[model samples]
Each structure stands twice: as C-alpha cells, then as structure tokens.
Target chain A: MTFSDITIHAMAERVITYTGYMARWQPDARERLERAAFDLFVEQGFASTTVPQIAARAGLSTRTFFRHFADKRDALFADEHAVPDQAGRIVAEAPDGITPLQIVASGFDAVAAAQFSREKSYYIARHQIIQSDDGLRERQLHTQAALVEALRSGFVQRGSDPVDALLAAHLTATVFSVSIGRWLSAESTEPLATLLRDTFDRMLRTAAS
Target chain B: MTFSDITIHAMAERVITYTGYMARWQPDARERLERAAFDLFVEQGFASTTVPQIAARAGLSTRTFFRHFADKRDALFADEHAVPDQAGRIVAEAPDGITPLQIVASGFDAVAAAQFSREKSYYIARHQIIQSDDGLRERQLHTQAALVEALRSGFVQRGSDPVDALLAAHLTATVFSVSIGRWLSAESTEPLATLLRDTFDRMLRTAAS
Candidate 1:
C-alpha cells in the first residue's frame, strides 16, 4: 500500500503538525503580529521599527499590539517563555539511570527536535537583531540566567545537591554554544539532539582526559 | 612564640588603612574614580548618581573619569577584568590528580582567598545594587558568561572537549552561588577554599547518589 493508505499516515501528520506548530509556529494573531514585526525589524532594523507600523502591518491597532507585546524589542524576543517548559518536560521524563547532565542533554534533544529545524533562519535573524542592540543582548543573557535557574531547581527537586543542581544546570546551558557552532556550519546534517549528545559526551571525555 | 602578636599587629594596620581610605575619598579624582563612584552609588543610589558627581567626588575631571571607566555603571563593575586572570592562575596551579570540577572549584577558592575577604562590604553593596537594577543584573549575567568562557578555554587548553569544558566552567561558576550564600549568612567562618572543596565533594557524592 502507498504511504498515504497506511494507518501511520494520520499519526505522522498529527505529529508533523504538532511539531511544526513549535517549529514554524501556529496560526494565530501573535503569529501575524510576529510576521509583521519581523519584516519591519529586518527592513528598518529593531532600533527603528515603531510599534504603530508593526501594528498597522499586522492589521491591528497600536493599543491592540501593546496588549500583546510590551514593545518592539519584545517582538524580537518572543520565543523565550516556551523554552524552559519544553526543556523541563523532557528532563522530567528521561530514562532511569541517566545522570543529571545526561538528562538535561536529553531535554535539550527534545526541545531541539521540536523546534530547531524550521526555526533556524528565524533564529539566525533573531540573533542578528539581538546582537545589533546591546540592551537586547543583555535581555537575552537575563533570559539564559533564568533558564539556568529553572533547570537548577528541577535538578534540586530530583534529589541532586544544591551545588550539583546548579552545576548540571550550567553544564546543560553550555550546549547552546555547541548548538550555535553546528547551526553555523555547512556540514551539519546531524539532528540537533545527536549534536547535543555527542557534544556532551565528547566534552566529558575531554575533561576526563 | 610571638606569631600571635605579629598577626594582631598586621590586623590592626589593615583596619587603620581600610578606614583611612574610606574617609579620604572625596566627593570630586581619576585615580580613585571607581571608589568614589561606588561611594556615591551606595550613598545616593546607582541610578540617581550622575557622571559629573562621580568624577567630582573622585577629584578628577569628568573626561578623566570617562577614561578610567566607560560610564557610571562601569564603576560598579570594576572587578570583572582582573577576576579571570586570577582564576586562570588558580586553575593552572591546582594540585595534580584533582578532578576537573575540583580544579575549577580550587580556582574560585584562590580567588576568594585573595580578593573576597577584604571586599566583602563592597560586594554586598554591589550585590544590592544589582538586585535593584535589571540592567545591572544582566551585566552581572554577562560577566558570569565571560568567566564561563575563560574557564572553558583553560580546560580546553589542558585538553578538554569544548562541550565538557563549558560544563565544567559552568559548574564551577555555580559554586559562586553557594559561596555567596555562605558569605551573606554571617555565620560559617570556614575558609572559602574549604567551603568550595566541601561543595565539590558534596556534588560528586550527590551525582553518584
């Protein structure tokens, strides 16, 4: 039978749509606003993009836009809130016998598998936008610090020491550097999960060596 | 036989000098600009203090003050540049056969021994400043990120995986949270080095647990 005739087709489609909602984002007013904001940010840059213009492009009033996002900078950094929850879910569900570091690595794998593929170009653009503004970069750093704190709390709940919890959280966050390296390389055919895992393993061996 | 007398005399001299320096700092010089800025920041408040007032307090021209620090905020963050070099030295000189986590922990220990004790009040004030300002807190996060990078490089040079190096660096940095906690508590007369060693031992055991 053809692939479409198989029972797995519907399940695969459901997964694709679900994951792609994370990857490409779902259809919503926020998506529309984001699209408009992204275009404005890319064209005139984050510093110059006015809220009224973004609202106009999104077919919303300035007041409505403000209801959704605090400002233009907020539009430029909309993905942060979802990341920690996704990571937490994955870590909480990892197979038994894995180390905290390994569990975090797996959490990263799940988050990346859900979000990275279609998000790449958008993320690169987002990175550029953040880099162009010192304040935005500072905010990004704050977001990361919060992420580490959240992950540390998770580890602490799992019976890790306060010190080890913080350590595991920090180590897990370091995977971002590796992810950036892989994303920027031309030969990166491997999935983000595999990249994160391999990077963690190699890093451990390197430390042991 | 007279070691106690010599130690007491040294302690008395340190108290005298520290008090003198605190008094001698004026409300207007480039040489002691950071100290003056810190004083103003603590007295009036970081956000309320202007560059001109900070320069005037230090006994330096505003331009000269600018030459010393990028801005008013820079004065509150004067320790970061020198911290990494001292930390690197400690890492390089760590006792042989220690685990990488222990090596990193020792580096912080050395830093605490050399710098932390004398500046405890300034640090507490700065910590308060950062806690009050979101921007300063973000700068602090950036400072931590840079330290992580430096420690990672040190590990990699000693032949670590780029990933694990980052993890080790991050974990080591986390000990700062615990150390800071102990420092603020006003109990625990344990040396920072001992506290860090105990922390590492505790983490190792927990990870195994």
Candidate 2:
C-alpha cells in the first residue's frame, strides 16, 4: 500500500509482461492486433479473413505480425502462460486448510474478479466467434488442456497426489465454464468471482447431500 | 457366463476384424501395423513412411488400407472410442453408494486391465514414435481432451455438479497416468484393474491426509 510497494508491484508486473513465455506481443501491439482481428472476424467471418488483411488492418507488416504470433490461429485464443501463472498464484495463496478443489476454484475466482467486469462485451464476442468455428473450438480446448496441465503441476508441486492435482485442474476449469456461462446470461450483475464461488458452493452442497 | 454370451462376444470381435480396421491378410494385422509403424518410426522415422509402403509390406492395397484407416497415423494410435462406452457402462453398473470419483476410477481400472498385459515392446515403440512427433503429440492431446469431455458428460448426466464432473474426468485421467506407469514397470503379472485401484486408493489417502 506504500508508494514504494506500489512501484515494486508495477515493476514486477512489467517484468512479467516481458519475460512471460505466454506473452506473444507487447500490450499495445496485442491490443491493436486483437481489435483488427476481431473486426475482420466479425465482418467477414473468421474462416475468410487472411493473415495479410489482418496485418494490414493492424498497421503492422505481415512479418511483424508473424513475429508476434506463430500464426493467425494463435490469435484466436488467449495466451496460456499468462493465465495459468496468475491463476496458480491466486490458488496457492488461498487458505491452506481448504480442499484442493476449493483452492483451485479460488484461483479461477481471482481471474474472474480481475477481468470479467471490465471486458464483458469482449468476452461475449470472443465466445461467439470461438463457438462458430470448429478449429477455434479445438484451439480453445488446447488452451484449456495447457491450463489444466499448469494447474495440475502446481498442485503436484504442493505435494498433492496426481489425482488431486488433476482434480484441482478440472474443478478450476469447471468454475471457468460456469462463470463464463453465468457472466454471459445478461441477468447477473455480481462480480465474476462471486458467481464462481457460488458455483463451487452449490457443487459442495450437492456432493454433501 | 453362458455359451451364448461367449459366442456373441466372439462374433463382435470378428466384426471388428472384418471391418479392415486392422490389416486384412495378416491374422495379426493390428500387431503387425503397430510393430511396423513403431519399427519404421524408430529406425527410418515416422515422417518417412508413405501409405503405399505400409500397405505393400502389410500385403494390402492402399484402398484396402483406407478401408481400415483414414491415414497412416490413425493406425499407430489405439482407438479411444473402443473403450469409453464400455467404461461408462461399467461405471454405471457400480454400486450406487460409491462416490463419483470412485465410479470413474473403477471404469479406468476396467479399461487399464484390458490393455496392461499387451506386448511391452509395442508400447515402447509407440511411445518413441509419439514423442518424436509434435503434430502427433498434439493429436493425442486432442484425443484425450475428447475423452475427458465424454467422461465429464457422463458424470454430469448422473446429477453431479459440473465442477464435480470435470474433477472426476481429470482425476480418472491422472490415475490412468499412474496406472500405466506402474503397469509398465512391473515384472510380475499384476492385473491392470488392481493397479488402477491402488493408484486411486493412494490418491484418496493423500487427499485425506
């Protein structure tokens, strides 16, 4: 909360922004590319948009665009490395006595708390685009599979059994699905984290019953 | 248990054979393809083999080969769908009092038991081939993701929470990793089901502790 603490936190975030393997581009470049890609995808459909057109729209060279992303398909999903570390750190910092699943859910809750309210429209649009394309759906699955691996490894490092590690991964992923659905319902105004917590609470009740 | 039951099971196995999903001329076509693919993969390498060479060596036309598989890669990996239905059936038949995770582990046990006693060399070859190919590895990950979806859906239908369903799918998959590793290392002929059960037991103990 001190000015020094704030400065240190900003420096840490900036370091992660550069050093994170999941980060494919500088923030400004990513934002521009995302805006260009989303507009083209929505206007002409994802399948029809060529990489050249996306590059042109973003005002970046085709080579530069490739430098930022391995390929056009890579842009369809969020970076896996960025999400998992944040999620894992949140889960790891939770109360130790909670069940592994609960710990994992708390991580998802942290993600939801930080991103959902600010980017509701972007989330809705992105979800629609992904749903419309089989390739994108598969890519989404791949992203999710990576997230699970990251989370499971985190749990295993914490001395959990492989099964509990996997359970934590999957349970956290479910919280993701549930929160996304509830977020898109246009009926809930609560923070995304609260929706996730409620989802987990409901599951625990069901299991207890 | 009856003569009729044995007859029907044999007939179904015969149907699988006639479908040319396995090789046609070789009585051990499945075994031959697995060995040949693994050998070529280890020696000449996976990228070098053409469909024609695999067909000629197997003593079949490329058309007959296509009757069995969509591509050469398809022959290398085992069919996942071949087991999930049986697994879901086995899980569904378990005692109602068992937890969802227990039911899933039981299903994993049934499938693993069926696969564990097979030729160790074949597995080693397959593992080598897959490890050397990134595209193949991605395909395998996609297959596992599909399996997770199937398992989670089954749990969801049984009135479990979405989170619990996902957790069950992942936990079962983790036990699968443990069971497979344990099965491969043993000199004694322990049942795969027993291995899976032991893994699950250890996981539960770890969670409780």
Candidate 3:
C-alpha cells in the first residue's frame, strides 16, 4: 500500500476501488499515459489492448498508469472520471433554499467552464472510441451512473428529499450528456458552459407537454 | 485466456448438449432454475452464487439457465428484458401531432399496465438484490439505458428531432425509475401503472421550477 511496496495488480485494484488521486509530481505523465493508450486503442481494438502495453508505450511504469486510470477501460475517460468529485464540491457548498436542480446547475457550470471549455478535441475522440464498441458504451453509461450517484449523495447531504435528490441528479446528468453531444458535434464559437446551461434551461422548458 | 474461461467454455458445451436431453423431460426447468437462482442469490449474495451452483441446485443444467437468462447478472432481471420489445411495439404505432413525451408516456403506461401492474413483490426483490450490489445496480441502469435507446430510436423513426427524442427518452427513464422507487418503498394498493403516470406528471410539474 505504501509507495515503496506496490504491485501492478494491487495498483489496478486500488484504482477500481476509488476515484484515485495522483500528486502533481508529474502532470505530463498523465498526458503521456493517455496519449499512449489512445494510440494503442486506435491501433488495436479496446478489447485487445492491455495496460502493460499502454505503460510500455508511454515509457512509464505500470504503477504510473494505475495512478491515472481505474483500468484499461478507463484510460480513455480520464477527464470524465474526475467530474463527480469536482462537481460534488460545488453541490456541497451551494447556498440554502435553492432547488437541488439549481445547485446541480451551478456545480456543472463550474465544471464545464473550468475543464470542458478547452477539451473539445479530447472529448470528440473519446466519443468516437466509445461509440465504436458496445462494451465501451456500457462502460460510459456506468461512468455516468457513478456521476449520478455522486450528485444524489451531495443533494441528500444538503437536506433535499432523497427522491427529489435522485431526480435532480439524473436531470443534471442528462443536461451534461446532451450538451456534450451537441458541443462535440458542432464547431460553434459559443462556449461549452453556455451550451450546457442552455441545454439545462431548454430541457426544463421542454419537460412538460 | 484464463483457466476459468476454459472451464466455462467446456461447461457451456456440456450444457448445450444436456439442455436438449432435459427439455423434453423437464417442462418447468426454466422456472425451477429461476427459483433456485433467486433463492441462492438471497441466501448467499449475488457475487457468491455461480451459474453451475444454480443449475445444480435447480436439478437442471447450466445450459437451461443460460437458455432463460443471459448471465448471472441478468437472472434477476428476467421480466425487465421483455420490456423494450413490448414498449417499442406501442411507440412504433403512436399517432401523429402528439409530443415525444406523450409518446413516451403512452409507451410506459402500456409497459406498466401489461407487465408491472401485479409484479410488485418480484420487483421489490429485484430492487433489493440490485441495490445491495454496485455491479448489479449498474447492470440495472444499463438495462434502463437500453430502454431509452429503444424509445429514442422509436421517436426518431417518427421524424422527431433526434435531440428532442433523446431528451424525451431520458425524461421518460427518469419517470420510470422514480416511479419504481416510489412504488416499491411504500405498501400501497395502488397499481404500478397509476403510480408511473402520476410520477411522469409530477416530474414535469417540478422540472421547470
């Protein structure tokens, strides 16, 4: 468990068991790992690619690969893997009396503005890789499901009714997902946060018959 | 590539041969297998119960179990597997001039009325099993996501905007999921269909504010 004593398998298990963190010890290492995995995934299919191969291609140790991703399947989703924690912080600190949905809106707006604004190409590539395979798409769904659970817990912590909290969580995720789909598909000058807020507002407007 | 997979492949071959011999003699093999799997899942937990054990407990072969369900994760969701086909039929034949939400409402109402109306206890058990295991719950979410895809495509087939179709699909899934949560948690004589309808209505009312 210590930095001195870790095996590749144990590191992989730890990644699966958590939204793991890495020190800012080597930021570029994360990108190296990502780029290496992306190239491997393109050369071979996702199912055929292995973590050790990715690590080797990246010129990093398997220990370093484990720090950035939960598994080989998660290497392509590094940015998304970080969203629940980032959004949860804002949800946890929102001012009182606003709706759970409103809190979720603020949380997502902050995330989109901070992270999604400049990651257009990265996300588009992820979308293509994920869409090409059924298992990857299901993994994507599970990833989003995890995000919903995080939002639901955050809303519950803020004293919303559990049912309302779950509903709000799903709404927030839908807006985030649909906005990303639009953002990646278009080459508009508008910011992702603007598209996300617009999607949230429009979804609410269209919720009724 | 693992020893376990080789064993499973050998078991599957044996099962296919055994299933044909047993089908003529064991008319209730599927039901018996389901009952055995359900009991084992309840007693030993989902992760611990294996397909071979369920087959042995049922006095059936693993092939018979596979014939009825796709895998151990799917054993508890036998009823849900039939839903997309059932609802897709209705969505495919809806009248024009109605909104996508209305199409979704009708589709869900048909599904709930036809299948979910009297299966309260069955669903409660499935919910308990699924909620107890993170993997099972994620599988359940995937099942729902498949239903959304069915709904979305059905809407698109009717010439609805793809974005509108997708948003309506998520909205419908949210309603379907929330209704099931409400239906199972409380002891009420009200039918599942009625609860589903009410939840859909209430979600729209709350969605805008």
Among all candidates shown, the one with the greatest TM-score? 3
Model number with the top lDDT:
3
Q: What TM-score would each prediction reach against the true structure? A: 0.74, 0.70, 0.75
lDDT of 2 by residue, A96-183 (tens): 6666675665465457656554577777788888878766776776677677777888777777766556655665665576666776
- The parts of candidate 3 lying over 4 Å away from their true place are A1-31, A64-70, A73-77, A92-97, A103-109, A131-139, A156-159, A186-191, B1-28, B62-74, B106-109, B117-119, B131-138, B186-191
lDDT of candidate 1 over B1-209, digit per residue (tens): 36754554455445444434553554334447888787888898888777766655654556666667898888878786666777676667766666567677546555777767665666778788788877787787778777777787887777766557766776566666666665655666776667767766654543343
Model 1 stretches astray by more than 4 angstroms: A1-27, A91-99, A117-119, A185-187, A206-209, B1-31, B59-64, B89-109, B154-167, B176-178, B185-189, B202-209
Docking class of 2: incorrect
Pick out the ten consecutive residues of candidate 2 chain A with the lowest summed lDDT. Answer: A14-23
State the DockQ, from 0 to 1, for candidate 2: 0.10
**Model 1, clash count?**
10
What's the DockQ for every one of the candidates?
0.20, 0.10, 0.42
Which residues of candidate 2, in runs, are more than 4 Å off?
A1-27, A91-108, A131-142, A152-191, A199-209, B1-35, B95-99, B152-167, B181-192, B202-209
Q: Each model's fnat?
A: 0.33, 0.03, 0.41
Ranking by lDDT: 3, 1, 2
lDDT for each residue of candidate 3 in A1-209, tens digit (9 for 90 to 100) = 54423454454555433422433444587888888899888888777777966876666667777877889877787776678887787888889888877776766567876777556776777678898876677778877878899998998998877777788888888988888888888666667888888888778866866
Q: How big is the positional error of residue A127 in model 1, measured in Å on the Cα after superposition?
A: 1.9
Query: Residue A47 in model 2: shift from native, Å?
Result: 3.0
Using lDDT as the yardstick, the better of models 1 and 3 is 3
